[model samples]
Target: MIRGRFTIYLTLLALSVIFMLGFFKQMFVMDVHPYNKDPAPRGKEYSKDGDFDWGTAVKYNPKQKLLLKDTVENILHPIAPEFRIGDALPDTVVRQIHIATSWRSGSTFLGDLLNHNMGTFYSFEPLHFESLSMSTERRLDLMNNIFKCNFHNKEVIGWMKHASKGENNFLFQRNFRSFKICENLLPGKVSCYMDKFQSPICSMSPIRVIKTVRFRVKLAEEFLKNDKDFPHFKMVVLVRDPRGTMHSRSHHSWCSGEECINSTVVCENLEKDAQSAYQLAKKYPGKVYLLRYEDICMNPYEEVKSLFEFLKLPRSKGLDNFIQKHMFGKESKKHPYSTFRKSDNIYMEWRKTVDMGYIEKIQKDCSIPMKTLGYHSFSSPFDRDNFTISVLSKASESIWPKNLS
Candidate 1:
């Protein structure tokens, strides 16, 4: 009888323990809060009697808290300021100047000349071989911001160093600009070719000159098509003799395929470029400056001085020194010879190097265009029947050094 009672009591105690444990497990482990549960805290409840109860309160997870903090930080950070008119013109008005041109023109030499002048920042070929997909506004915005921060101003470099963070920090060095040009970061933004121009950034400058070559006609078409804000902008149309241009274009590694051939197509293109330049000069008489490459190379100082005067920039003592250094003798070694060779003798080297057949073909194709630009017609005393062909042939032989035996 005693053993039976003891066993029954022990069984009752074990049952009680299991029941308590299962109840606690259900409350603490099995019950899950629904995703749509009331977000308000469940800490306390107060009735009219002022009775109070305490419970768990809702709080964000640690990971969630961290994410929120990061979001706030990003929102608070100041974005780089974009170029805008009426904005305090950064100490230097010419924050950046893009030397736009077809390859192998004297753009590099011109770039060097601009670089030597104080207060002018040079970005060589920033837009060349770049795509034009970016909306002109966005491109201008980016350019303005970049210039605001990166414009090699003697005063701003120190501030840039302090404000620069992460990748931008490295841009404070002068050499950084050189690296940016080589890497073609600006061009890379547009997939390596300039298809359009809509940027206010380019317009913001008191002066912006686009150095261009054979596509001068196409560029004129673009300007006509697009609505631009610059009423007083200027274009300096630089031309070299077609024969000389062809000679330089042929040997230049950058010129390839059709451009390499001194065929009728090439002559036609040159004629179109020259005519286009003339047409632009006619259209915007005061705004267009026609500069012959041969004339400029022969009398660089005079030409550059006149150019600066035309642009309304102060012709300083430093600019005079730059012209002297780059214009004459071995001091000009700093200039890239492959692109800017100033041999008065080699100006018309195409006559010697290009074949007679090609010369005749070019003359025939270019006669109309040449005449349009005021060149003597081949039909004149130059030649009776095939005047165009004969004149070009004679001129090619007489003028082009590369053609000389």
Candidate 2:
């Protein structure tokens, strides 16, 4: 008993010293810019066939992409030049990319694929912060804080408040790996690894890829312009056919037997998700990369290669080997997309498995988005439509937001 007490006392003493050191560095060395608490306007929500002129969605100037290289170089304040274990990063340059989608939509699979690349410091949905019970704008703001590395922000603080309280297991799970990967950059090895598992790719990586299925498409677009808050960013929206999506969700008994053998909310959300993704690609020409789940499943190599090029990441042989191994390996089922079967068969499984009536309804509700995403009707399942080559995109520009302007 005395030994245990002595151990506890020493631990406390060590932590106290570390805390003081952090405080000393904060006051005398590192440049401390006050965190921005100014709330940004809530982004426009997704709504299809509405009276709004924005029509499904519109594009940013490709020239605007250059702004990513700009950063706040001159902080005209009294501060010392110093380098710490984890230095403050510049808020410019294309350093972070996000794969945003909805639940059960192959996000986890895509995240796994990105993690296969050594160049990418991949985090599996750090912003999948399930406890932030605030407004959507507030949630986006908190998410911005996370990407900005503002660990002390109220929203971030609350999410990880229990982290130090013997909750290493909780942190490693529940989409907190992204936060912990960043923690690897922080000082002190004992506190981070004393009770937790560290990500293998925690070494100094230039690119950071975080995947989240929480935010809608419109909200993601709003951040395209808010660089001061979000910094250098690129986003990809992963979309799967509504039938396939419903089929995947209905695998569990609780999620089936409502609208189209899945709940009404499920069906409705699928349509909304498609529209949201469609709208973003339509409006933000070079801003958002909309990837179809079918395309990835059909040709994971080509599709992922295209995305890597878009994100300007070099082709990684490690990623190629990972995909090759998973494509044929009998890896026990973990992700929705990972299996012994080829991804080609996974894309069109819904057509053969789901009811014909359900397919028609999903197609009807999501026709534009379906067509926009290269998904065809029951009448033409083999057509394999492509959105980027469609005239619909050109037509969409005419309906751009005009009334207020």
Candidate 3:
């Protein structure tokens, strides 16, 4: 009788323990809140009337608990597992991108388009605050480090702290939720943001982009070869017709330097960069993309689709809406710096506005680059004025250096 009672008690105790464990498990599952509960399904276009929530798009894992960190290494390092050796990066890994372009090259619009995607972390001209005193080596290091999401560096931190705040902020036009949150913690927001949010967001984002006109295209070869930290890295060399580029520069007061406005200097850089781009494209294949600003202005939807394809990122509705609203709509007031543009006509505006003599000069100086870039020199004033006569050639018709040889 004693043995039987003891057995019964043991069985009851076992049942109670199991019941308690089940209760706690149910509570844990119910209480666990994901950072983004309603992940707007990938590739599904959001409602035309609704605005896409960028915060939700960040897609921070709900399962991973956030650990507060005081050290740079702890904070900046990505939570994602390292990518193994492969031609294509796994969906889990971030793809680092650089937009190598010159001023007035429609880079702002392009950068914004890329940023509109769900998982992109865009850094706009992080080198805007780059000192003249910085050596080429140091600048390269800074560029590499930015790709690595190491914003804890003093120089990078200084840039964030000193950079312009509003429309002209070099970081990004569309602020991340992390950045917005960190803003509330200021006095030390710059460092605080870099440590707690910016670096981590950048490192974890599936596509990390940095658009800069400061760095030359040739320098990218080093990044492509030397940086093992970012295995899936690519660059887009965004070019525009010199006539359009120069005419656009004329409108802005700050574009006074020889590098900015001089037809000779501008054309020469383009010519050299074209050769470099051609070589890079050949060597790296899919890694180096040459994009013409006019092509996008002409057919934003198709061009952008092609760009997304090149990046191997899925097309999203936010991107579609952005292209539709920005590319087609007419704004009441013109903000020079704003991405808002009458894009369809803006590319051709230089033809009507620029002096014929200046056009002739640009045509002469920029002839080689123009040819390589699929642009044709005007034979006459009528030719320049005639919208029917296409000055742009198909991508295939443009003679690369090897083809020319």
TM-score of 1: 0.48
Model 1: per-residue lDDT, tens digit, 1-405?
533332333333233223222222222111222122342232122234432211110021234334433533453222222321112233333322333334455655675665554333333332231224334544444333344433343223222333233334222222222233222323222201111111112222233333323233435433432224333344555545554455566665756656445456666666666666556555545454555555556567777776665554555567766655555545434233433253443344454455655455555766665554333333332242332242122232122112111
What C-alpha lDDT values do all the predictions have?
0.40, 0.50, 0.65
lDDT over C-alpha atoms for residue 286 of model 1: 49
- lDDT comparison, 1 vs 2, better candidate: 2
Structural similarity to truth (TM-score) of each candidate: 0.48, 0.60, 0.73
lDDT per residue (tens digit) for residues 302-322 in model 3: 878777767777676578778
Ranking by TM-score: 3, 2, 1
Task: Write the residue-wise lDDT of candidate 2 on 308-382 in tens digits.
Answer: 766666565577777777664556354554433456466555656667666677677767655655554664433
Local distance difference test, candidate 3: 0.65
Q: RMSDs, each prediction? A: 26.1, 17.4, 15.7
Alpha carbon lDDT of residue 174, candidate 1? 27
